[model samples]
Target: MATLDIKLKKANKVYKEGELVKGVICVDAGRSEIAHQGITLIMDGSVNLQLSAKSVGLFEAFYSSLKPLQLINYSLDIAKPGKLPSGRTEIPFEVPLKPKGNKELYETYHGVFVNIQYSLKAEMKRPLLAKDLQKSCEFIVEYSNKDAKEKALSKPVQFTISPETLTNVKEKQNVPKFKVKGKLETAVLCITKPLKGELVVEQCDTPIKSIEIQLVRVETCGCAEGYAKDATEIQNIQIADGNVCRGIPIPIFMIFPRLFTCPTLSTNNFKVDFEINIVIVFQDNHLVTENFPIKLTRF
Candidate 1:
């Protein structure tokens, strides 16, 4: 017999731009377990296409061909994932996002290798009980480079906001309020220990390495939606060993575009969901996105 299930390493049912998702895909193989080949782990997501171009040379009149193209997909494959005996295994993984335009591969004749918009599906191909147990997840590849700007913000301060979703609407048409608003706060706790994460790059042609525990800040972030939002800010934050630079997470709070709505409809109350956005900056410049939700509400 065969079975399949998804076990997320963190409470990560959602994600933000440039944020890394952590977890394991667990698969159990029942009778007919023998002749069982190892397992494969796959990760993928569908994304919206975003392309931009610049004219550095000719083509000022014919239509510039020097354009930029980026794909909104991140995934990895574990050839022989970890096994848990009895034909069951939980494979761990880490995927880095090259958010829109962070960098792209191009050609002179093809313009930009634009990724229009495609669905992403990362799964495992296993043989067990005629049913397949796999770990699959989805994420967004935003057109925002806001994550890098806040890198200078120092830390040790654990920062996050409440209310994951922020929504407003017009009264008569049940339309979500176009310009909703909310507040977020940061905290400085006396940490009895430190948070850690690993960076793996096998293409380096060298051995993997790790650094000591020297950090500056602990940041948290989330998102919001509306035609417009409140001029947001963070305060009262504290840190342990390092300084709290901006005292908050990057993009502070991002905007998720409206996926469903009719211009004729209006309402003031709706759910604006945001999972906690977190970052732990290590002395070596290793950024770790923590598990937290700064979900908020505006009524």
Candidate 2:
């Protein structure tokens, strides 16, 4: 009953690119001593795009091995070939979390058909006729530039867009034109910080029912040709349940999740983008929407 496990030195399993990741590999030979080859620790990071066999055409199937993708596999020696003495032993190792030659690394993300992952793996190389021990730990990696953040945040995101700009409201219909004004403290937002802003509605002919701020994510894959979008309401401030006049300013603020959400990023083959969508619903079932694109980063 041989087992292997990975433990990180930091409490949080988050790291930046070009940083050193330190951890320990715990190997336990339950109730018996074991003899085997050397132990190795691997740092593997890659962007994997998987295609179903049934969906592949004849030409694609013939050249399946040449699919476009990026991969990095770096191995470090942990111990020499020897026999294990006891029940449990710990080996400390540190490796740089960097791709070859200053290449940009996209934030870790897992999607339905596409995925970018970085993992720290440990393996016990046993001789032939025996199963080897293996363990893996996944971590999050974010790219950040303080200089870029400063430049992005130097100016506020101010825009006045009519809901009809990108809305489905019929122009022929007598739906009144609504104007939405948005102002954010900074155009650049930090992942661990809360986004603070105010939205004002004016020139509204219909009764305002609800105002909501939505966080939208756009995922692009396959050389920016294939894409998927998802949106969720992050902040909602009800002005009036039934009907109300305009001219009142509504406050909006939402904090991004510490985990499971990546910063805005772009790469050659994959990218993640974020935006703020302002929606105003009227009492007569009329909708006015505005999209304000913003930059999200970790600084």
Candidate 3:
């Protein structure tokens, strides 16, 4: 059987915008010499919207409600085909992966309800009655730059949660009345950096049992669906198996590992968010929980 393989020249598969994708298209003519049209290379990026809606009935058919938006669509004519020898031939090519418009390219993401994907295709066109031979490969795109880092540093820190300022949303069953205040060094932080903060339990209706600090990542599917999961936890931080009096402050710090977390990102279909979960357990089995959102950026 005949074969066509598209191999990226560089070993690195990860790329950013505005970079050139260099590769070679190798064609292995199976048995006899072949004649064809020109070779075409197409590169594009798109965001596919996926929805997790329940089926109407057991026998009802389902269709996708989301549509894919193209971020980049470019084609290159690698060569005007002539005649190829019976053996193997290689053609080198390079094409810019930049998007067409001023809109920024989104980072590659694979979620339950959304996916941002990119692919490179090599097509070997043949004459009439013969099928066109095609091959494709996928690559990753990350958004990173010096300017984004500078902006992240200069961005004001808005990480703070005060029980006194707690709104009507804090009402929950078996939750004790308490006033806790805390602040972080910065609102925007790199994944490599440690999240530093201080928590003070000013007053409480009951004795404090334990304190737990948790790192949570919230992945929302557009404005319709939202999911929250704990990425990490600092267990028994303070007042463990003990009680804390009023007017006591405890230091809080945790380094967000890159393994289970990603930089905060948002698109029209989905988003990822990082936050700090402050859970204060009372001796009476009551709970006081507060959460503060923090922005995470890539290094």
**Backbone clash count, each prediction separately:** 37, 0, 1
lDDT value, residue 161 of candidate 1:
21
Off by over 4 Å in 2: 49-68, 110-114, 127-130, 144-150, 159-168, 172-180, 202-209, 224-246, 258-263, 283-286
RMSD of each: 21.4, 4.6, 7.0
Q: Identify the candidate with maximal lDDT.
A: 2
Best by TM-score: 2
What 10-residue stretch in candidate 3 is worst by lDDT? 55-64
Q: Estimate each model's TM-score.
A: 0.32, 0.75, 0.60
State residue 159's C-alpha deviation in candidate 2, in Å. Answer: 4.2
Assess the local accuracy of residue 38 in candidate 3 as a C-alpha lDDT between 0 and 100.
83
Q: Any runs in candidate 3 off by more than 4 Å, and if so which?
A: 54-66, 146-187, 191-262, 267-270, 275-292
As for TM-score, the candidate ahead, 1 or 3, is 3
For candidate 3, the lDDT comes to 0.69
Candidate 1 Cα misplacement greater than 4 A, ranges: 31-38, 45-70, 81-84, 100-122, 126-135, 140-299
Cα deviation at 235, candidate 3, in Å, is 18
Predicted candidate 2 versus true structure: per-residue lDDT over 67-104, tens digit per residue: 43555578998999998866998888999877756565
Q: Estimate, for each residue in 97-133, the C-alpha lDDT of model 1 and write its tens digit.
A: 4444553311111012112222234354545653434
